[model samples]
Target: MTRPDANPAPDADAARLAALGYTSEFRRDMSLWANFSLGFTYLSPVVGIYTLFAVSLALGGPPMFWSLAVVGAGQFLVALVFGEIVSQYPLAGGVYPWARRLWGRRWAWMTGWVYLVALLVTIASVSYGAGPFLARLLGFEAGPASTTGCALAVIAVALALNLAGTKWLAWAAIIGFSAELLGALVVGGWLLIAERHHGLGVLFDAFGAGSGSGYLGAFLAAGLIGIFQYYGFEACGDVAEEVPDPTRRIPKAMRMTIYIGGAAAMFVCLALLLAVEDYGAVIGGADTDPVTTVLTEAFGPVGMKVVLGIVLISFVSCALSLQAAASRLLYSYARDGMIAGSRLLRTFLPHRHVPPYTLAVAAAVPALVVLCSLLSTDALTKIISFATLGIYLGFQMVVLAALRARLKGWRPSGAFTLGRWGLPVTIGALVYGVLAIATMAWPRTPEAPWYDDYIVALSGAVVIGLGVLYLVTARPYERGDAPAGDAVPGGPAAAGTAPSSEPSTRRRP
Candidate 1:
């Protein structure tokens, strides 16, 4: 088939079409189930497990389980907002395009910048966390060096599979995601048996290892962190353009993904609480890898090894999803001229119908991040977390802005409508977003030697700084006369204009 923007006379036009996923080069022919399967397979219960450890340690024990619940509820609300927008504007650019249509390009650029950084750091952090799981499974030491190597190896394999085109990534996600879910259920059941014999008193006890001074606030923050585990499920929406019946299927898939993943996570978290040996040991203790201790306490050596295997597989799946998400993000940004070397980064391999250059560019930073773990593990982890949270903040802003637009009588018909629930859900997401940001900086101690709060703050600043840099360097690329959603059906070019996909209302550039 001829590409949409293909020009037999010009290589430049052909390259442009290929960059936009219009070229026959890297086009994927996977069935809808394959794409949906990829989503289900990439998102597993282990994400909830790993994130639960982070929140529990930060906010204290048992109480942290409630935090996960809260995070899930808050995310449900936010997901509603996204569901509406995605159904109406289901495209590859995802949030950026939605925000640009509702808000403006300058703001959209900034939003995309932050989201891109968030996606990048997410990939890096998963890579870092994958190492310990592999080492434990293999009965090898899981130091910084070993973990880094394992992460790099996973990234290498996943990248290669992704470069093979959509089918391989889809199947890999299915296998990896399925194993993680089953393993989580097995571990949860083991913990449940342990809980039943031990009694349910600890389940009701709000007490934890913290000072009990600000338990509510701490739990709230912990829940936010837990919700972060289920973060990338929205990547399903980002790739909607590639999916068949995307307007109807993507939002449905998203709802199912979140609820299924959340329910599985909740069961495991409750079981983990019952099986916990030392609340203080798992909480106030500075162990980033609480899963190891939790499993060991519940199932002995055999259980610990099994849980480790599940976690390793989970991370591998997450790494694959992350890489896939990042490539699409880069491709989206480049197609819109938001990034440097738009033509090159957007180039697709016609034979495979894939964005090979975008994949290469996306993988470069993460590989560096994984390698840098050898130098300073603590620093890398802190920075990655900071970056992830910062992106979450940006997402919050965009959702609220779009919600506000809807409230002002701006309605677009789509498959997923928030309906009467729109205002309340949007409000809830905004409130939770504010609280989450505030709590992300907590447990700060002057004497702790290293503070993640400062790192998070600095990372946020750098993200904004990059946006500023883009504005300064790419001002000429900004199209001031682009139409809004109502003005163009397909995009800017559809309105008989120069196809300025930039946010049309903003003039700061």
Candidate 2:
């Protein structure tokens, strides 16, 4: 792809700079550790532990590990594609901003709004999830009041961190991330040593010994569950603007995260599998909290309590990072005038040199969604998954668009292009994306619940319907291009060019 001139004229320079930060100059404050850690913490084994349970119950058992590998392979391809685009266009707007550059403003607006909604939904899920863990730690049930209180608290903490600026957030992430990493290793190591008699070979062979489906299917199903555990790491890309030289640094961080996080998750999955003496009981979906169930069985109440403590920490960290990602996404859409309350959502406090108000709004919206879910307990999981799947689908669309641009001869200005690996990787990611979407709509249970089977499609339709309404009512008000903000020369969104992959817009703060 031919690159756009960073700042072709004085007027262009001013406009681009204005897009960086509304109230202050753009500052790339995130480091390698922070970027990678942010992703790592969100996808740690603790989070994976729960995901494994969900997936196991959904698509058989143990085979979830094999499917985990499949999804990882799929994510690997998409990451490669992301590496290429992000290296070329490293802006905070992430997938949508990239889209704007390749496509045009209108489509970019649509993409950003859809993505923002999806991110908000994800935040609600994560925040909601933190409640039960916190409640359990405090020796209480995950009642509505408990869940809502925890959710609100988590959002409040995230808002505070963002208000403190990128350095503070990075430091907080580093500390939390370190704790999570060590916690996983400690817990997983203990589980392994306790069950060492099972033999290393058992980890590979224990899959279908009694499941009646044979080893292949059992392992595949287990892998599927394992896959969802690692799904949230890609949120790293959304925080690109915070990192210095993001085009170069973010890709490196993302790659490192995949390696470290993938190994860590796989190791934990193995530990859990080996530790469970009875696959039938462990995988029987007793309480839908297999990790806790396994620990309670293995080490009794004391051991169970310790493990729960670690899980609580992990949940808090994951919720924080997730909330941060959601805020950035909302901020990006608001900067482009895509959201309903665009002006308020676009505010940046000069004292904090961050969008404190916008961050608050972002956090509150998701919490409200969670509060709304309290009234419909039955639909909570389905609704959250449905919305999250829509966001993931949007991610796939953006990557495909980027790939198509490359195929049509859009070469990168930077040295980080995927080179010979682009087509194969892009194709794999797209294929996986389609499969994932299909799986969501698939009838997982023999007798599927009405909402479980169709929620993703239904919720996705509603999100799109809202987008259509905005297109008709708000499109004219959205400037053909984003308003001015602080930007650097040779930045991600190059001004004054017809982008090849996304909407042609310059810089998003």
Best by TM-score: 1
Model 2: per-residue Cα lDDT over 1-509, one tens digit each: 22343423434323333343332233556777888888887666566555445446334544455555667677777777777777766666677766765555556666776777876776676677777766776778778878888877776777777678777778777877887778778877888887543665653554433355455444443444544555555667777766655656677777777778888777777677667655555555444565666677666877667777777667666766776776776667766666666567666766555666667766788878887877866534654566656666777877767666666666654536666767777888888888776665554334677755566677887888988787888663244344221122233342443223333222232
- Candidate 1, run of 10 with poorest lDDT: 1-10
Residue lDDT tens for model 1, 376-486: 747444744675576577768677667667666666566567777677778888897777666665545445556444666666777788778877886623643333333
Work out how many backbone clashes candidate 2 has.
Answer: 42
**lDDT (CA) per prediction:** 0.64, 0.64
Error of 1 at 438 (Å): 2.4
Deviation in Å, model 2, residue 272 alpha carbon: 1.4
Q: Each model's number of backbone clashes?
A: 7, 42
Off by over 4 Å in 2: 1-26, 51-59, 196-224, 282-287, 297-306, 377-380, 446-449, 476-509
